[model samples]
Target: MASPLSALLLLALLALPAARDAAQDRVDDGGGYEDEEGEAVEEGEGVLPSPGQRQGSCPSSCTCSPDGAVECAGAGLDSFPASLPADTQLLSLQNNQIEVVPIAALKRVPLLRTLNLQNNLITSAGLPADGFMVLKELQYLYLANNKLTQTPGSLPASLVSADLAANFLTAISPGTFGGKPDLRSVYLHNNRLTNAGIPRDAFLGSDAVETLILSSNSLTRAPLGLPPALQRLHLRNNKLHSLSGGAFDQLRDLRELYLQHNQLNDRSVDAKTFTHSRRLEYLDLSSNNLTLVPRGLPARLVILHLERNAIAALDSQGLGRLRSLEYLLVHSNRVRAHAVGAAAFRNLRRLHTLHLYSNELNRVPRSLPAHIKVLMLLHNTIHEIRAQDFAATPELAELNLSFNRLSTKRLHPRAFTRLSKLASLDLTGNQLTHVPVGLPASLEVLRIQQNHVAVLGNGALSGLPALRELMLSDNALASKTIAPNIWAQLPSLTTLDLSSNALTVVPSSLPASLEYLYLQNNRINSIPEGAFSTTPNIKGIFLRYNRLPPHVKDMFMGLEELQVLDLTGNFDGTPEPGADDGEGGDGEGGDGDEEEGMGNPQKELPQRRRAVERGTSVPRPQKT
Candidate 1:
């Protein structure tokens, strides 16, 4: 039952792995090598000469296709394989014990365009002094997850993308990537690189480099002299404490910048640091030491993640310029209601989701964007909700105010009357003694659990025709206080949870569309036959930990769709006559066969059938 805001954040974090895998797949597959005629040659279609049979044959331990692609990964070789095809265009030697990449072996594949040497034991001293300069046609090189203590100097000028991640590199030499005009991506993350280890002009000549990932390093400040063409930069999980004014002065085309999990503070970032990045669309600065929302954000930003900071206020200077912003996550901060300026979010016309949960606010912030659809303000100290709290946001669909100090008396009578499109409302863990009045008719799910509610007035649920799920568990409701026809107003009601209440017998007149009923942990002793006759489509009934006596099987005789019936922790005594010889009658407390059936009822039916063979009487519902 995760909230929508939490689920969206999880999806964003999981996208990193998918992106990495896609990049690796492009390097591994080589997009199908070309033949001599420049025609596309699909892999596994052309078989080359057998290994160890000729001078230009494939290595004995590798597989070669007619398109000049060789794969020798995980071959357990101590050195580079010999006798590679002279026209090899793609070579994969990853996941091997090869420590040295002899230059002579690469001379055979002078046309190699993609070379993968990742996940090996290759060290700096083991590589050639001039790097892979002999492979003149190389375009993609993957040397990640190796033992290199320094960058491989003088990479081929034709290199387009290089992956050097998860290495022991301590420094990047000046000319490591200087002259490659076609170099577009460079991954140097998960290394021991420091600010001083990189030269000011380390990437001076690589003007085409668009992506630079230097995350998981020991950088205390932004690197200098970044390429002007850089479009995406990932510097997360570093020790960066500040961004000097000129750090991003040259990156005009930057679109996505990730600086999360750093030590950046309000003063550490200059106001003009991002002034030149006008095209920036995605920015993530979460898990930092920021005490205020950074100013001078790009107006074109679509997603901004500033959660898990120490920010205490929101002003027009920090948020007024972002008009295209759609998702704003500022939760887990110290934002207060009074500290928020009146025009803080006045210009964000396209914003749809705003998450300010776990803050210090005592009331909803005024001037919320009108078009926002989801607002999560849970885990706050707000005690009252006024009538105009959400007057401007009529398009809001889901609202969560759980884990607050809100009481029915302090809440205005028409607090939520304006939210005509609100579909789900969660007010759990509150101090309300009764359900809030004037709920919108469009509400489909209402959860007010863990409260002190003891009564449901006659019209408490009158107009909610679209309500599907109502969870009121952990309350003080009693069977006598519940109106018998109260559920008739909700025609679409399917799931109702009334467990952990003070009901003596099952409530009657349940909605006919009810599918699941949870009345466990009550004081009920009898069902009064046909208690569930109206709910013909009910599938699961949980009445455990009650005072029901033995031989209650007759109560569920006509429930054709009943799939699970959990009667555990009840009927605690010796078995009645003609009952099975077991710990309790009707498999009440034995081995939890009935209890475990709550998830998969079909798996527990055989055990019950065996009990019936031992002189026990169990009701078996027939499926149509």
Candidate 2:
């Protein structure tokens, strides 16, 4: 299509009688490319998977290139692979098991473009101060999924696309990408970056960037004064506390924008904050701490993420201005779930995904758009969910209504009667003692964690013909309570979470697709011989935080490929087995079984948590 489009193109087919000549060339050494045993990144694609793909092979730590790039990605490289000769154009080392990338290793390839090392283990690129000078012709560098501590590389003059997501990097040097005038596509999501340390001039001169993603960082201020060519900006999951109205006034041509999961307190985003982004099409501001929505954005805004905030109610006067806005997310805020204004997003005719989970909603409000596909309202104070509430959105596919204050009053028997294409429904975290009847037959994932479900009765899952994941954890379904035919009913069930219940024995009734089973924090004292006799494909199990009797002889059974078993916080005064099971008694007494699974138990976070009801939630539903 165009310059950048040509760079992202992949897979070209050879045609006609020239095929014979191409085959002849393949027979010779100078022949185009040798048929390697494994598949490599198809040339010219925007991204590429690593050797561990279904195609497999190459050393676990090695980076393999198919575009005649031996020096660029060969040998068991634990670091960033060295560069190759000028002939090498595109280089991809994605999904490799690499650990670290030594900065000096990349200087050898001066003409390299499109360097993709995503999903690799390299922590920090550690580029030398002169790295920009050494790889002058390099472009498109992807460094996602690593343990980086800081930005280790600077931008080259010709560099364009860049991705540094999911790293430990804490800051962005201001002058890093100063003068790259034609640079485009910058992705830095899921990092530990901050604003004070960032050079104010980091993006001073790049005038051609179309997309800039800096989500999941620790930024405090909005990086304003961007080039006129900027289009998309992603800054979700940051630590931003406030922003002056003129923060993003420079980007007049901006389109898509994401700013969710940040500390967007009362003073952060004013109505005029995005006044310069008039052409915006997508906007996400969910999971922030905003108390009110100040006015002053474009009427053409689309795709809003305002979930998990402190907004108690909507000031209709403010949200009514956006006539073209679509996909509004106001879930998990201080607003009463039933207090939503009918016209909140009535102008959004193209809305698709709506998230309103973990709020004070007692029931679904009326006047919902009919085109919604994904609706989330789980973990709230909602007392009931009437099927008629969703009649407006007939095209709905998935619905989440887990962890609420609702009691045994079941949802509308025909709750999904109008949802012809409904696929998934979650009704966890409530006072229900059984499965609801309104779930659609086309459902796939049903998460009913942390409820009073003591058994699976008649209408538990009557219409679900294609359910896959069933989360019945934190309930009272002891060994004999879960109907044998309950799990057997869903042929596609794969993940079953029954942890934190009163189950005393594991049931043999399980589906063939079952892969993960979580049975931790329960009264289960032992595993019977045929606990998993039927589920041969099971892979992982969590037996941590339980009381297993000492007299029991065997543990997990029939799980041939079972990868992990969390036995922490469980004890019967067993001796050390010298394994990393983390088992030991609650006290540091000689009992070793209780310590097995607690070795590396993830520490609790300070964020507001959804409190699953005890006998309904795992970990005994400690109050949040």
Candidate 3:
């Protein structure tokens, strides 16, 4: 026998998972916009009903609970239901075809605190004048995803949160939100709001309004005279071109601000624009046209996103005061090696992650932060790695240098010796002919795919006992040049990818703990008996698009845990006269051809195997 207030709280808690799902969909489909309506729904508090509750009458089309909660959602009603519950406190009518809000019907439930009319066809003209002024005890009003051209002229004074997103609103009168002292959150995103449509004092008496979302609008400039108690403001995906000085001087409690995907530049922004927001923590200015980093950022900032800009240089003065910064993303810019000052990042002692990929840098930036952990420099023009390049950052764990011009001759022998804690390294799409020496013994994942690597000499990967994953696809590897027992040194190896190579046969002496082996798109013609004898724990073996002959099922005799054996696109003991050599051209040795033969058997094998019997079936190979 719980109280009616407790039951209403339980119902609100049950709706949170659906709200989170909707929020995630908005974030993914709306181009990285924050979902403020979801937060408003979570923080809404309903009013308590008076004592001596009554079991009110229920409508035939709605489900009524003894706690004064009624649910009539998604009932396909073209008009509002005629409810006669006098003590009802919560009513949900979302996902319906109702076109009007009957003022006479709502006047019956004077104790209503929460009214949800989302996803309806209600228009502005259909709402009667002073429709919501009767429910003086209402606190939460949700009218999102409607056909309203304007907000309701009058609202209750006890309203705590209102959601008007995804509407056709174009203007807001000065008194629309005035005289509401308890109002805190208002959502107006994905609307047609313009700069001139909003008056200067639109939020005049809403002194407690903290979160305001005006993103996805047509505003040319940020709104002036915002509430002083604002904490989070979202203005992304707008047409803003400039910001005047003292624009945000009143919002002293602001913490998170989003201004991405706008038309801002260096000349249009003042240096002291954000100097008043001393407690700001997260700022996103990505996808703009600025050529240099903005100056005069707050000192207590923690995360800054400046990616997808036209920035070309970094000076010590631009980022000298952000000592509390932890994450910095400047990728997809025009930054070069010489343009970066020597002490540009020396002051950021707490920086942990730095992303400089897709730039014009020819070398690593000088004076990197000492405590950095993750560094991404892929898709650059860097050709060499000096010995003392990583001496300043000893705590590095992950480094990605893929899609660069790094060659074996230009890379120093002791280039990565100082990175004792390095665990993951990606050298994909390079020109290295052999494995680099002096790799850290603590490495775990190594990706050298799409390179010109031809040989794996002895002692190349000897000391790496903690290595687990190794990717060598799209290379010039052949069975004769690979050193014997080269993979036995890695005792903890689990996955090995060698697809799209020039190997004529399966490499021997694999690790005993190997679980997944990918050897597709090769020139292998026969499988030697006991080819996988040492690796008894192997679960998946991919030999698709190869010149494998029939009667190779004996290779999987003792593998008790064998789950997947893909042998599609291989010769079925009757070779065609003019058939091309396997998916990756002849096994002689150049960069292998990258054709889409059989389409990544690892991902499609499970479904294809169940549809039709295309490959030979081993004795105990379970279908996965």
Candidate 4:
């Protein structure tokens, strides 16, 4: 029933008798221990020091905690500190300048469980053959981000994880990790490993290995003899071009396989390469040379990324086995409308995301999964959006059709009527002359920039009660064609872009919730006193490259929340005296005669005033 401290005190008392007996025996031996100076040293004095004087050794900048842990990171140290505490269990020397790990450097710290030497200049030659044999209890070791050309030897058998990534290791020799039965994770990515340099059974000794990361290597063929318990394998950014029979037959527990950015093709992949990877959930085969979807995909796959390939079509058989697939990314391929089968995704009821952007499709793809929530077809040749093109996905939330050949005449009136839950629609860089109508009420963002929409009609965006961002920049919208109450219905609108247009005056009747307003690169000559009076929430306004008028009073009135006001390149006019006093005067006192506009626009105020009074302001005629 004794507490830990009480029992330790009792043991100390018991050891005192034995200590006295040892001292008596030493006295009976005719002489006690002698020092180098022939002085007879008293028994238990400095030789067997008291607990208070038994301090352990540590580097000047390092902290040795009570639990035998030492940390000396970022010290610019060029070598391991001499005389480390023998009981030290954890040592962190990360971010140092130490170039070599000398043999016997850690021989005294036999209890070390974790050793961190990341971000150093360690090389294979710096580590002796049996350099780490002294650390019998080491469980975790990190040598990543070093200059090693080969794996360090003599790793403790108790090691659980070893991180050797970001090094110059060219190959993994046989028995490199031999006898490490408890090894669970190995990170060798970002190295120069090649298939010819690695022995066939390099991983045969690591029977318990679960995660192997070989990404960013030069391996032209898949490594052999993978542990059966492997769950995750990363071979991305490699030269792997093929998979042989039974390549993954033993990896039944594999859940994630990353083969992206390789030279893989149908001819290089075994027809049954993934036959045993039934539990795999994520498969990445993007950026390859495959002309068709590789067959024998697991039915439990949750995500398949095959973008940037030579696959020219969506073959029904290619997707027939992935019934549980939730995401299919095939963008940047050669897929054309005619190459896709009518039932390409017929069995993918759980599919929620599909990416077909940057392809050769000339029409809206059909027969997409019904539960799709995100659809990307941007950078394609699709010239039209006909009715029911996306009718199957009523729950679509994000659709990116930007950078296509879409024109006003090719859009069906009810093209997006079925997508009631749609939240974002991108139509930038298209040929549309006007904003499409019937946008879902739940929409939050609309991008239609770089188009020819000369006019924004009333009710063009009436149904989008939740719209918050509207981008209409780089268009041909003129102030005369934009309705005075164009944004009155967008109560939730927070951002509006009308830059690079033909606007001669700021659009009036902006929404009260407007926050960011971009009107740069336009012909706008004036901002009326009440122009921003109702938009109290306005935060930023861009008015550069415009023909701003002369002296004006209360031009920024009611814009108390505005943070950005861009008036660059505008006509410079003497502030009517008392301009800050909310009154217009015929004064000359000002900050100075600032230069702006194509010429002195102050002389044209009378014309601008008349134009404003008539509820229309045409851009001034340009001189030939």
Whose TM-score is greatest here?
3
CA displacement after TM-score superposition, residue 493 of candidate 4 (Å): 0.8
- Candidate 4: segments with Cα more than 4 A from true spot: 1-56, 549-554, 571-624
TM-score of each: 0.79, 0.55, 0.85, 0.81
Write the residue-wise lDDT of candidate 3 on 254-298 in tens digits. Answer: 998888888999975677889799999998889888888889888
Candidate 4 per-residue C-alpha lDDT over 491-516 given as tens digits, one digit per residue, 9 for 90 to 100: 99999999999998888899999999
lDDT of 4: 0.76
Return the lDDT, model 4, position 136: 77
- Model 1 agreement with the true structure over 1-624: per-residue lDDT tens digits: 965423433442354335455544443343311111111111111223333333377878898766567778788776787577876777878777777777777766777778888777777877776748877889888887777878977888898888887777789987788888999999887778999998888997899999998877789998988888999998988899988757998899999999988999998876888888899999999999998888888889999999999999988888899999999999999999999899988888999999999999999999898899999999999999999999999999999999999999998999999999999999999998898999999999999999999998678888999999999999999988888789888899999999998988898888999998999998888887678888999987888788888667557655767766766556774334323444444344334233322422332343343344454554453232
lDDT of each: 0.80, 0.61, 0.79, 0.76
Candidate 3 TM-score to native: 0.85
Each prediction's RMSD to truth: 9.7, 15.8, 8.6, 15.4
In the range 1-624, model 2's lDDT, one tens digit per residue, is 444324332311112113323332332222221111111111111123232232222334433354423222333444544333333445556555566444444544445565666555554433344444555667666665555566654677787766665667677765566678768876666567777656667777788888776765678777755566778776766667776757677787888877766677766767677777789877776677776665776788776667767877664566777767656778768777456777766766777877777667777767776788888877677776676888788888887776677776656667667777888877777788777766667778877787888887645766666888888888888877766667677788878888888887765667778888888878887776676777778766676667875333234432445545555555564532422222333311242232232321121100001111111222210222
RMSD versus native structure for model 2? 15.8
Clashing residue pairs, backbone N/CA/C < 3 A, model 4: 433-453
**Can you give the lDDT of residue 255 in candidate 4?**
97
Badly placed stretches (over 4 Å) of model 2 are 1-206, 209-225, 232-250, 256-276, 282-289, 315-326, 410-412, 457-461, 478-624
Stronger candidate by TM-score (1 vs 3): 3
Q: After superposition, how far is residue 72 of candidate 2 from its true place, in Å?
A: 12
